[model samples]
Target: MKRKVLSIILAAALTGTMLAGCGSSAKQETPAVASDTGAPVSEQPAESSATQTGTSGKQTDGKNVPELTSEPLTITLWDISTEDPGKTTMEEAVQRFMADYPNITINQVHQQNDNYKQQLVVAMSSKQAPDMYIHWGGGPMAEYYKSGFVNDMTEMFNTYDHPDFIDAAVAQSTYDGKVLAIPFGGLSGCDIFYNKTIFAEVGVEVPETIDDLEAVCDKLIEAGYVPFALANGSKWTGSMYYMYLVARHSGNEEFDAAYTQEGSFTSDAFIWAGNKIQDWVKKGYFPDGVNSLSTDDGQDKALLYDNTCAMMLHGSWQVSGIRADNQEWYDENIGVFRFPEDSEAAAKGVPQDVEIGTAIGNGFSFNCWNADGSVDQTKLDACYVLATQYFNDDAYNQRRLDNGTIPSIKGFENTIDDANMKVVADIFFNASNVQLWYDQYLPASVTEVHKNCMTELFGLQKTPEEIGQEQDAAMKASLAE
Candidate 1:
């Protein structure tokens, strides 16, 4: 969410949109500080810059405060968002940041997430990468860093006030020994957003197991309600169910194995889960015409808000959207619950795949373009300072929470206000087992193959055995590459 804001700044700077919406570009502040000689490098203090104030309160030794230059620097950044001009909380944060260091101007840019991904790949491949661009966590992140377009933030991690600020997020951003990007915050992806009024009228408690869930779905269907809001046409949205199953049935070990090796997707754990999903579809659990619904077209919202659909399984990020679209509807009816694990799986003491609470959203990075090696370290330092400080700042975290988001920063959990959301928070913080999103961990190519296998299974385009064999082949090809 914050990435959307930061990217707005980046885009505006790079494209020069000339929109009156952007506040005036902030001027650089020069606070005089001493160097080894009687000369002053810049007006900003090395330890406490015009923009970045030390959170430690006490400046300890070995904290190297590099000298800064007086030269004004502008770095282009990219982000994606649904917010209109100037109202974005992140845009507000950028405005506030400008107040501190007048010299460093961040031209925030914005784009649609899907479009940005397509555009960024082309731009980076052409060596026209922005100074900074927001990126997702997981496999793509690792791949992009490997492609040599991202900066490693390890040094910034050590220098920041809260060394642990990025620790939880690092789980997604770190790949094969390198930390490629800063975590904006963590996200919970396996929540089942439900309609409380429907549960009450159906006289059904929240389902505690897969059998229990199936029974409830039957009752809901009989009661003239859609049991689940699923948008299969959007493709990736359908992947959420697969991830939940993978988390609950196979647990992290299976998920991690599948991630580390493509062959794991063909294991019994995934095959059984795929077959079960098809079984559920035959039972008519998902909404009617879901196969044709686009995920981004607000189908999930319509199912929940318009059609009396009982549940929509998605990330915590959707909490705000549900509430925003229909608060009275949400307040009187909406609730969120975890997906039920199979009783057999649970009996074996198999862990529920609970998503980590307070996880960071995907993060953006400062990609400096030092064509002549003239990029100022101080400017880089300033970018790190802004990224680190602003991300952990209470104001930004509170804003995210107000918008129905869970923050990943330490001690930032109290920002949530919804009672239903509190349950999700509890599930996340106290979960015995937590796993990253399945698609998040796999290479895009392999992830797509699995999705195709799933589609074939759901549509009965392939037999169970055929699906298994296809999955095996997909894994083999991915590993071969």
Candidate 2:
């Protein structure tokens, strides 16, 4: 029998207005809250003998009773999918969940992607925090977890059957051996996506090493095509280049040491990365005014689609947008590749196959604790039901794949039919190591330094050593706090 997968309309009506303003500005001071109580205010589930099987074929043996109170309840969810098809997919899931549990009301709030992180932090520190919110799980999440702004879902995650959850997704959401959030949506990482037509025009092929990549760039430039499409106005887009270069040069151990403050950010690896990016800029490898182009405006994408640029380095999340905008062109001409190995790094004994990015995914974190250090059991339970329905349910997972997201649920690979999605999954699954994005991997203060310095490096305003020193200073200041 053919299964009925949830059809994503891609026009899901968002239910709530923006609770916070949009901007890159963030509050520097942490919110004043009472000290941690060492335990959640809500009652922990006791041991149980009864086990229940969910439709996904996973059995739950936990003591969490699935009963809901007869009284009406409402919970809020802040998410970064203000536009289709993400908004539509989430809306449908919410509708289905509400139908199943008529007593609970979910106020789905949508936020623009550009200002989500900043606004979320502001909301969390204020009285307007939602019962749950979606976020990229990494350093920002780590800060939230440390400050007790979010709840520990370690117990809840274990109680549920998660046979389909991907290991990388789970690891990304876990911190200090505790599951802090529910794995949601697709697993993403940065990769090189190029126009095969342009490569053919320049008589070049996908490069396997740093030298080969530079050679390809030269040929493309000689043919009057931009070697890489870049937009640094938002900063993070350009940071991808620097991040990959650092990964190739230093590998994960050194980067981790530097991020955790056991070592200095002003390392030889980091300086080399900055130098390489500035060298590429000097070589006219990027599009004009790369520093001023905004990625949100599709300027970088326009270069690739029109064949004005030969390549782009971005996360796999761009796959859906490309296919949606031009399916036929994408199917026939687009090709994906892992970032090439740095020849110098290889010569210095760095592994040739080490990937420069991470398999980071977005997920929902429970606002389990309130400003007064109390947990509303009903709200927490209701939030869990909604989160699991959206992320863990078979139909919802199918919807994610159908919408071009590389779902974090195990066994989703078999259901995925898109050629481009398969290629991305293959790259993600085969990667030897995946480091989280530097901006997300480091504290906010240090991330700002990294992004600013990356822009300055590309603009010829700062030397590699200067960029490193600035980042190291920021890291020390953040660590000191």
Candidate 3:
């Protein structure tokens, strides 16, 4: 419970990156693809409710879905969709599912984002694990699967009719060559959501390179605005900065090598990411006690709301959170922009366009087990129905779109009319590759190390080398096991 990373080997190889939790690297890289139509994933639909083929050769309609029991049953479903649009969207889905299946009831639990992984780890290690839960698929999900905390949904997925999810989303959800979880969360892209009014007032253009970004930060600071609204209490917020730095400095190859142990975390890119974060801290580019600001308490948004901060580099879901809280303010101020490229690095042939975020936002993996650890067949079928049928159906997706989410399914572009959402979708659509977050990508023990390192790195308590060395040590320990 002290950390999210557990130094143990999964039965299969590990894969993932920092998102909302901690973890190690993949033994093999999953190919990043877009839609089946080879179009940008952001241009994809949420759900068509049209006929589609399952992974297995068979296709299915509602009548062919495995029947649920008539006996009264209660199940718990956990996720970090604690805020609006996501929260309301999920609640509605569960309501619809239960309305149809009158004998079954789902207890949907919305956990705070900051403590979700740690709490889920504790739940799985004890008797309190939920029947089904949302997770950012990567090494930690692999850890959960290997530790017997989750069911292998491959067979169920293949047997059920699912939305034609983008190839990248499916690939991210699959682990060790099998479908371990369903991609219920939308295609998540992380970018800097800035106050357009601030830029206009400051007489600076949106940055297109790291250098330009720094210049903009300098001007923002001169204007007495915090350049970035960072609530590192969630840790993953800071991890985005580090991941983007690594991506721009050396592209995905460096992180990929570090993950596979083919290279070191002390690689130039990692070192650069660490030092750059520290430098930003010293430059007063961030707020005081940035790490102490709790994202769950809306502390970061508070900064944005008051105009104390001009920009927030965060997940696309913030569109909904911001819009839900103060629609007028969001419409008038907030705008989206991808993390700027490293122009100098690009000159050296280091591709600066690789994206850092999630193709699969959060995956839903079931844990339907009876006492003595035997599988609960009846509950598994019902849970799978909820996940595939209820969660990703047209109704569920329309709510997501209305809330401004672009799911990883093809053909839904017309539903998104928000200017901010359009920019985010375009970023995802144009990205050649998408990297999952490190906290979600690494194993438990390594994730703890990574998250802690981000805190220390941004706090300037540890040098980049020191942080990288610690991460490397954690990675080696996990790999050895």
Candidate 4:
């Protein structure tokens, strides 16, 4: 498939609305030394006007900062942000970066969410990877790093003085002790977001256990509400439940062992998770035709907005969309809660406080070398600068906050005024253990089995045992490959 390259001029026009919301601001102070987390020094150091040569062979200032090249260069940036806010934030950030470094041209490409991972893999294999791209840093990125398709950004991260990123956020992009990507938005994790009005009407408080959640669902159903709004057609949305259940049942150790091929994927915990999802389906907890609902056009959200559903389990990113749909409803009616723990797991000594999702945030990765194994030093340097300026720059970080995103950058949390966003951020900050999303944490082939089996399990076409066996077979196959 041919990739579409968007023009900078067209991008500017499309993002005018976002530009209006994210009005231009004065540049902020640069950090002196980089750390994964905590506040950095706010004072800017004085520098000589004359450029100095650095030992790394790059042109530098008196502070040893690499000077940008004057030669015209066009770099492509691939990201999965086809909607507003994210798209706009990215475009506006790029435009600003371009204005600062006139010689650098960015051809920003937006790919559909579902197509992004596969497309990136193909592009990398074909030696057509973009110079820089937004990616979920975990197993998939580690794969790319192993194949030598990703750049090690540790030096640049250190060179840029660390930028007040969260430790978990930085660790997500690090592979083999090398930072491979820049941490962008805030750390993300999945949780149950409920309609306060619906819960109030049903006289049910936020659930704290599997039984409580089921009781709440029953109440919602009895009160003529869809118990849960699930976009299982996307598969990954449904997988969240399974992932959480498995986490509750088995915890991270067993899951990691299976992922690493040290244990079997067809464990009791995996089977129980699959069975529970099927049980939920049989109990009418999910809406009719949930298997056909699409998460991509906000269809799942529509259920909550229309008052058809009482709750939905989703990631922190959902806050932005909900706020956009109805700010008042989001502020006054939305309530966030962690996914309740399974009683069986709790009885078995599994900690209820452990979260089932990852603390990793999304960020951009630079393609260090060309397909034929050639390095473009100038392009690499420019890519790092672009990534840093767009994500770590304080002004752009404010834009992220305004967009209802929890920034991975430190100290930006104080700027967050959105109550709904703050709730999500609190959950992220308080999570005892944040397990990476299964599809993103496991190998690609294993992820495929996970999603497919989840879909089948939800559809009631496969038993939990069958799904576990299928997943195990796929995992073994991937390991053999």
Candidate 5:
């Protein structure tokens, strides 16, 4: 409830629009930003940047920060960034951090996003946990904190100068009244990225409602173009469609109730979303064998790039990813619009503006534990400096911006030169509520069941009723445990 209220307030405060709207061209993509070096490099007097300054969040890091020494320290850092933009940006941050501290070695490892959670679990079980790792904060984060894998960085934050982040970002990274992770990227909002050239050729306007969307899809199919590019080989890709459909069909009320086990997963809204997706599938709207095509291998983008598909419902990060591969093509072709609303649901008084996305993208959480189960002070201090200072600096922010990513840290308003990114920013900041992805928001066990249900749901291997019952059963058992 508090999170919702705070989101509403933040939404109200950010009602203003960006300089360029969605229709603008990408002639001017990169903007120069003046970086504020809040945390200093080793070349500077480190004492000057360690003073406490900003304060507008919860959690207190009361743990001790060990004094820095020139001793050699090798810390492993794990993340899911095997693809463009993310892959290069994270790697550069590591290089800069190492240069700043010549003695500290960061063994950076990139893992595929689809299998990251399972790999992390296996590593921890095998007693090979990375010193610092990336995660989407929610149930899994809380579970990790409870199991003593999280290191509270509130004390480090209190003692060091850090960039000002949105309250929502801080809220998610915090667990058990402690700051467990550091925000690494901008808010990730989900929207429909359509091919502008294809739309013009098909002679259809941008959709305003689900009815309009369906009409557009029919026309696109008649013109021999796939309506959507979806690679459900990664189940979360299909889950995005299910999420938005459910949100539009009944608003956040049903999902909120369903998630808490207070309402049935077989409710009218879930069934409606399921039925709608299957109906589209029968119409040959998505790529053939979407469940077999992998987004990790760039198969989804392949459809759009070749003009075989007219649109893709995906995260705002798709902007950066697309641009990284071909800026000229992206500039000439890509345009963004919010997911079409459900007019019937809105007329029935279900809130239609509750968006779905993450307030913080991927956050880096520290696990500074020794073999003896005690905090490793030296490691904690090094990671603290690496995350809060090196990773959040202006140079790093510029590189992210160059890749079309807006940092979660504040004060980049004048620097977002890309029109699509500007449009996404406006949509993201003004939403009444942004729901986190269910897979990331649910517990690990429930998440597995949910993803499996998505695969089966899209494969037409199970009835909507069957998956709903399975989900309801999973939810209830998870709650009971």
Candidate 6:
């Protein structure tokens, strides 16, 4: 079944009192009264657990007893992506949690992604962050941790003996060598998805190098097809292409170095890559008016579904959505390819870079606790079981695979029915090196600047040199931070 986004709309008019009471924001104060006694202040638990089979597929050994003792415990938890008013999938998941442990009542709150970020900032400044809430780990989470908005869960994480993921996702969730939060899952980026039917129709073959790719694009154009469909208006969507080019041209090490080591965007690697992209744009390799494309408006999909564009480079998760939207097109015509090997560039044009699985999308970063920086031993114990168990659960792995999401867990394979998606999966699983999204590793504002500059370059509004200067300045500022 297609999992729909939760539609529950929360009132943005949040009060300081509500934020503290629900444990949904960072305004919570660890009070001395609550810490000293270690006695039950209220009768309710903050979070409830479910009695599902363990990751081993055996019945739980019954370690925790679900009893609602008269202890004053309030857990402020918030969830974004549960804004849908009709039927909340996560709420249903939370309900299952309630069923196992009837004593704990979650003071559950919901927010949209953008709004949640803004409000979370406020909660952090006010020192009232939720006992536990969903958060992105890298930048924002790091900032919040520095501000003392959330408690460290390192001990809790170690106690659980978290399983090793093939992609080493644990490291991404860690900050400055401290394991901050549990990673829910991660996305593998830059897999080339193509239409076999289009290839056959245009008599073009999938290329394996920069030159080969250019040759194929030229053939597709001569046959009256847009070589690729890129959505620049959505911003990040367009960065997918630029990142691939950079990784293929400059190589992962240097490209990554630029983010860490202060360097000019006009450096040899940057100029070479920027010039290549501008050249492609000038040649009309991408679809016309791509700058105005809306990610949600079906324009990008039309490029694929209507057979206007031949390929798209994105994370593997889109396979299920595309296949569900047009099964026939996916079944017969679609194919997947890795970024063609770039022998000339410093970073092997190869997609994977083992340093850290760099890719896009957010995942769980940290687990929170009650006010006064106290962990309800009972709840913490339950949470440990849930996180580690879910990480390796076969059913959970299967569900993600069914959605065309490639799991980094060792045994989880792509189970999508489409041959194209399966081929993509093989390339992903076998990739000797897998780097996470390049943009993901950058400071958010700088990544945005890169995206905007790439778009302007595509539109011929910015010269290659001009883009190099602006992007170099932005990266310099970010590095200073």
Each model's lDDT comes to 0.61, 0.69, 0.77, 0.70, 0.75, 0.55
Q: Which stretches of candidate 1 lie over 4 Å from their true place?
A: 1-69, 82-87, 162-167, 356-358, 372-376, 450-457, 463-481
Taking the tens digit of each residue's C-alpha lDDT, what string does model 4 give over 256-299? 77765677667878877888888889889998988899998688
**After aligning candidate 3 to the native by TM-score, how far in Å is the CA of 347 from where it should be?**
1.9
Q: In angstroms, give how far residue 208 of model 4 lies from its true place.
A: 1.3
- Model 3, runs deviating above 4 Å: 1-64, 71-74, 81-85, 126-128, 369-376
lDDT of 6 by residue, 215-238 (tens): 999999898888888777766666
**Candidate 1 residue-wise lDDT at 420:** 72
For model 5, give the 10-residue run with minimal summed lDDT. Answer: 12-21
What does the lDDT read for residue 40 in candidate 1?
Answer: 22
Q: Write the per-residue lDDT of candidate 3 for residues 1-481, one digit (tens) a residue.
A: 1123232333222433322221212211111233343223321222344333233422123223566687899999998877666778889889888777768889999999766777887776555789999988877777777667778767656555556676778778777666778787787789999999999999999999989999999999998899999999878789999999999999889887887677889999999888888989999989999999988788999999999999999888888889889999999999888999999899999887789888878889988877766789889888877887678766666666666677777655544678888888888877887888888788767787899998998888899999999988888777776
lDDT of 1 by residue, 1-481 (tens): 0111123222211210000111112122231232332122232223443233333332211233322244687777777764632138667766666655667687887777645655775676566778766766665565566455666665555444432332455555565555556665445545788888888998899898888998999999999998988887756667777767766786766656655563356677777777778888888888666667877788778877775688888878777777787778778888888888777877788876555332557676666635553444565666665664554344555566667666554444444558876877777766654555544444555555666766676666776567666655655554454
User: Could you arrange the candidates by lDDT from highest to lowest?
Assistant: 3, 5, 4, 2, 1, 6
Every model's TM-score: 0.80, 0.84, 0.83, 0.85, 0.83, 0.76
lDDT of 2 at 415: 51
**Residue 403 displacement in candidate 3 (angstroms):** 2.5
Cα RMSD of predicted structure 1 = 10.6
Per-model clash counts, in order, read 29, 3, 26, 4, 2, 40
Point out where model 4 deviates above 4 Å.
1-64, 356-360, 370-374
Give model 6's TM-score versus the native structure. 0.76
Angstrom error of the Cα, residue 473, model 3: value is 1.8
Error of 2 at 444 (Å): 2.3
- Could you tell me how far off, in angstroms, the CA of residue 234 lies in candidate 1 after the best superposition? 1.6
Instruction: Name the best candidate (by TM-score).
Output: 4
Per residue, candidate 2 scores C-alpha lDDT tens digits across 378-449 of: 677667667764444545555666566766655555555666667777777776666777776676666667
